[model samples]
Target: MAAIELRNIVKVFSDKRRGRDLLTLDNINLDIEANDFVCLLGPSGCGKSTLLNIIAGFEQATSGRTLVDGKQVERPGSDRGVVFQQPTLMPWLTAIDNIAFHLKLKGVAKAERYDRAMESIDLVGLRGFEHHHPSEMSGGMNQRVGIARALLMNPSVILMDEPFAALDAQTKLEMQEELVAIWQKRRSTIVFVTHSVDEALVLGNKIVVMTKRPGRIREAVNFDLPRPRDITSPEFNDAKRHILSLIREESTRLAQAS
Candidate 1:
């Protein structure tokens, strides 16, 4: 069985000011296998993050069921770790403390919590900086801390919602490389949401494309171009062209429909 199963998932939101309910995600279905790095790729407002949240148990689907590890997702649990767009680390706590906070809340001894958090810090390449507070870190460094915190959970799946979106271009590239390395080492299942086609291509072994608003899956493309892919290679460009053509075709269809 797949590690995560999303069966005919649908999500709708009530818009009080608009006086009408908004249909956000429509008939989304996906199966994520163990250790698979899947990227949900689409344009803005495509409900990618909402879908991620449903799998994370941060939101319930209006219809259909979401199963993780053969159990239905009812609410946010430690089985899934989520890293948001912004690093939501505590200001008062140092990096290590923030990463171990969940353990602390669970009544773990301080030494044990710190020891566990150290593994996560090492994973994200935040060793010496572990003692520094979030405010003392750069945007990329803080984001690393967020990822470390999520990894410290040792959850069944790690869901990231554009976690590297806010970083500078250089930092983003570095973080992307580090993330792929970490994923390779840990072999953890990841569901990452992003609007950038390039980002998806760089990180995911499978890219699931979504349509415009009232998002539906356009296609799930398997990409096995090998690690450390050469972005400028013809094969890479070929895949990019194909993916872009699909997006354009979808956009044209939507335009004509409206």
Candidate 2:
């Protein structure tokens, strides 16, 4: 059985100002198997984030159903961890404390919480900086804290919404490598949402492309390229070319409609 399933899902948003409803996602059907790294790739405003939110139970679908681990998703739980675009950490809390916040909420003792959080802290390579507050860290460092916090949950699936979009190119590449390493060791299912084709290609084992507004699945491509993928390789270029063509066609259609 798939670790996560979205069966004929549809999401409609009420546009109060326009006095009409807007369909954000339409007839979306997806099945994510265990330990698979899936990236939702599309143009901005294509409802990629919305779909992730639905799976995370932060939002409800207008129709159809969402299931995680064979159970319907009704609300957010520790079984599924989410990392947003922003770090969203408490400004006053130190890195270790921020990572341990979830454990604290569950009424776990302070000593145990700190101990468990330390593992994730080291995993993300923020050992010596654990005592630093968010205000004292770089954007990339704070984002690490966010990822570490999620990792400490030991969730079956991790949902990310453009978590590295704010980082510089070099930092982004480093984080991608670290994320890949972590996934390799932990073998957790990851549903990552990003607008960048290159980002999706670098991180995901499978890429699901979506169409513009009122999003629908355009294609689900399986990538079997060897790890530490060389972006300039012939196979990589071929896959990129195919995906680019699909995205170009979608953009042209949207442009003409407008």
Give lDDT tens digits, candidate 1, residues 154-250. 9999999999999999999999999999999999999999999999999999999999999999999999989898899888888899899989999
Cα lDDT listed for each candidate = 0.94, 0.95
Which residue ranges in model 2 land beyond 4 Å of their true spot? 256-258
Q: Model 1's lDDT to the true fold? A: 0.94
Query: Each candidate's TM vs. the true structure?
Result: 0.98, 0.98
TM-score of 1: 0.98
The candidate 2 region of ten consecutive residues with least summed lDDT is: 223-232
lDDT of 2 by residue, 1-258 (tens): 999999999999999998999999999999999999999999888999999999999999999999999999999999999998999999989999999998989999999999899999999999999999999999999999999999998999999999999999999999999999999999999999999999999999999999998899999999978899999999999999999999999889989999
